[model samples]
Target: MYALKEREMIFVFTGPHGAGRKTVAEMSGSTLGMKQVISYTTRPPKATEVDGQDYHFISPAQFVAAQADNEFIEVSTVNEHLYGIKSADIELMFQQSGSIYLILNRFGAQTLKKLYGEHVVQIFIYADRATLEERMRESGDSEELIAKYLSHYEDEMAYRDQCDHVFENVDLAHTVFDLTKTLDQNLNRNLLDLD
Candidate 1:
């Protein structure tokens, strides 16, 4: 667990599908004093997912209206479903003393980095192809869906080099430890360099 005395810092986590970015983000936010901003999606909620916890579920019509109104900070469509992060949601998360962790796709992360510039600390999470395939299979996804994800994986991998940190999440425990250490050092540096 991290010492709560550390100042807040916005962390952006991105990765390929089934890379466990959301799980790692939630764990990191709980360990550190930060808020995990649950994104909104037009897709139906999964069996284990809870509204307002995993995501803010919305209808396609509502999502389209929001997009037209420019309510989303970043939005993207994947596999025919739309997902978005709202600007107001981010503002609310950062309102307190704690940091905000935004778990998004590469396109969303790029949009946020363009918007926030140096205020964002981007982390790319990754796993071996076999591990990712096994994970997707365990999740009960169809072969067609898995193949689609595998096709898009390379594009997301290309974005990894642009991140401030690349976390290979094959071993969750060790990855979390390394992530915490890296975050601590980065936070301390940012604090000391505060103007």
Candidate 2:
């Protein structure tokens, strides 16, 4: 694919688990016609997930082989599963489209920010603890997993202050609408800068 002539934005969506970060990222990709940065995960796919769409599901052995070969820009273990973003994949995405969005944890967000500087826009989405728990349960997460996520709530929340934008995700439609507006303004500004 040909690269976009003008740089637009790389949106990194992150928040505590169950905060609707992935949902917002997915919505933005579909609603705004943005390219998605899909990561590789060792975790088994959920009933609603599709390989290469939500994530590239691989075996633990495959994950380790890729890691040993330095295939990832950032890697993290969550719930005993390996997750990583390949450096080549991200570079290719940037080359193909100026507008790209990804769902990431705080560590991945920080790594991308360090690598890309001003080109990366970090957005933190969060909701109340009760709402988080409800959402997790509704999504069919195990009770143990939900408990574990809640245990690290404070740690995850602390990263919000470091983000470029933070928004409560209690209302999905409103949040997405606001996010799209933010992206549009940023895109317009960046396009103008190219001239």
Candidate 3:
């Protein structure tokens, strides 16, 4: 556990579908000891995904009920499914670890950056359209679903310049190494500034 006196850092990984944002976030978060903030989703879990780990899978009714109660700090709809980050979950994660990682869309990342100001670090990861399409196909996404996601590719990529850091995820190992190194340098700089 981190000391209460230490400043909290919120790392937001934003990218279009099939950009490997979640994978990179998981690798870098694990390497840097940052807690992963699992989000709630109405979408069904993938075969390789675990409940409560990859996402808090819930029904549409449950999602609507939680939204009615203002439980989420950020929410977005993707491919006809709702996804959200519960405000309570963020608080709990902060208590457990000073630094945290979140896999969110561009809009959600913007919301968090607005809320946390400088504490929020936005990282954009991207791949070429052909690579993204190939990745989605390999991940078992339907052709129709891939088309829907790809339709917004340009819009999503527009936010890349807004991020604090941007990475091209050509090689997973190299991308993870670079992400971890960047975070380490930021952490060190923040520590000195805070002191």
Candidate 4:
């Protein structure tokens, strides 16, 4: 894929868990040639998740060491699990591709926007609460975890209006198409000359 602008913008895809943020961001990166910053995690891999592809699964000690080394740009903890996007990962993406994309939670998303200023484009993936819970259930989330997720909907929407764009992930095909097209229109599109 060709690049559109000289001043590349980083894409920050964010929303609550089960909102398909990772799926959509991966699709965008694959199809648009936008590089994504791989994050490191202390959590165990899920069924379909690949080791290097999904996350750099490491130990808590390793994670803390990396944090101390200033290896990550943003970091967060959920329960006993730790997650962070390495600063080197972002720098490498910018070196390879003009733009970059990464998935994050609402807090991380806001942090990225504030850090990058105009260079960041935040897209909030939103779905109905019921749909979110159902998706989580289908993904093998425990009832307890699903309940935990469901209770956070209100807090998630507290800053929804601050995002540059918001959309539902009901239909993957439609949502991807719409989101990509909108991004091209609002961003640089000279690289993607597809008709």
Candidate 4 residue 142 C-alpha distance from true site, Å:
1.2
TM-score of 2: 0.89
Report lDDT per candidate.
Answer: 0.83, 0.85, 0.89, 0.81
Best candidate (score: lDDT): 3
Query: Order of all candidates by lDDT, from best down to worst?
Result: 3, 2, 1, 4
Clashing pairs in 2: none
**1-195 per-residue lDDT for model 1 (tens digits):** 122233556789999988888888877767666788788999888777899998999999999999899988789998899999987777677676457888888888998788777777999999978889999999888899899898889899999999999999988877877787687676663323222
- Local error of candidate 2 at residue 138 (angstroms): 1.2
- Give the per-residue lDDT digits (tens) of candidate 2, residues 60-156: 9999999999988889888788899987787687777768888998888998888777878999999989999999899898898899889878988
Between prediction 2 and prediction 3, the one with superior TM-score is 3
Model 3 over residues 160-183: C-alpha lDDT tens digits?
999999999999999998888899
lDDT of model 4, residue 104: 82
Candidate 4 per-residue lDDT over residues 11-83, each given as its tens digit: 8998778889898888867777788877889999988798888888999999999999988778887655899
RMSD of each: 5.9, 4.3, 4.4, 3.7
Residue-level error in angstroms, candidate 3, position 160: 0.3
**On a 0 to 100 scale, what is the lDDT of residue 194 in model 3?**
29
Q: Rank the candidates by TM-score, best first.
A: 3, 4, 2, 1
